[model samples]
Target: MANIKKGDLVQVISGPTQARGGDRGKQGKVIEVLKAEDRVVVEGVNFVTKHVRVGQTQRGTKTGGIETHEAPIHVSNVQLVDPKSKKPTRVGFREDKVTKDGVTKTVRVRYAKKSGEDL
Candidate 1:
């Protein structure tokens, strides 16, 4: 299982500090997870500009130009935020027991190691 998932809050644990105009310590929700590349695109982080060829849509609407958007960052550079503490922390998994309709089942749950709270 991945430590970080789409829609999970995360903070950039690496990179230069804000004073240096870097994304270190910035917190944002995970917009997408690039599992194949081991990178994640966090909302409002790692902004990059892309230039594209100008074109027109089938409806005659102009499209393509310089656009800014969040770029994928290495997964190791981010850590999951602890809900209770509201701080970045390591994630851990534990077995959870659930009983429904007299059927007991074990499930793995993600939790914040720092606050010992389930995420």
Candidate 2:
């Protein structure tokens, strides 16, 4: 079960920035999910630098030199931001009852543990 998903707002609880406490308590939207690596790319978080050669590219002229971008952070190091409280909150699944075509069924829905609000 993936507790965290793309476009989720998350706060960094711990990671490489722990040394400087830079990324701690920082919140950002999840840009991508790497299920296999158990990591996630958060916007404006976990930045990394890479050197590249300037050249022409499909998008446009490549002016490459020490390019920086967000790197993947471990999912365990971040927590979902609560919509109501706007703080980090644990996620839980709840079964909601619904009727369709004269049939009643229950579906799992994600909710915030702190405020018990739908996520």
Candidate 3:
């Protein structure tokens, strides 16, 4: 199972600090997970520019221009944020017993190692 998933908050842990104009300490929600590439796209991080050819939509609306969006960063470059402390931390999995409709089942759950909080 992946340590990070869509909608989970994460922090950049492998880039230069903000003082150096890098995304080292920025935190954002996971927008996508490219499992095949082992990378993730985080909101508000790794911004990149894309230039599109000027064109018109079928409805005659102008389209295409310089646009900025988050780029995929290597999965190892980020760590899951601890919900309790709001800090980057390693992830660990443990079996949790959950009861639904009076039926108990054990499921593996990911949690922050630092704060021992669910991710």
TM-score of predicted structure 1: 0.92
- Against the hidden true structure, what lDDT does model 1 obtain? 0.94
Instruction: Name the top TM-score candidate.
Output: 1
- Ranked candidates (TM-score, high to low): 1, 3, 2
Question: TM-scores of all models?
Answer: 0.92, 0.83, 0.90
Among these predicted structures, which one has the highest lDDT?
Answer: 1
Kindly indicate the candidate among 2 and 3 with the higher lDDT: 3
lDDT of 3 by residue, 77-112 (tens): 999998889988888999999999999999999877
lDDT of each: 0.94, 0.88, 0.93
Q: Could you report the Cα RMSD, in angstroms, for every candidate shown?
A: 2.8, 3.7, 2.9
Q: Write the per-residue lDDT of candidate 2 for residues 8-98, one digit (tens) a residue.
A: 9999987556567578888999999999999999998888898888787888966778889999998999999988889889999989999
Show where candidate 1 strays beyond 4 Å.
115-119
In Å, residue 114's CA in model 1 sits off its true spot by: 1.8
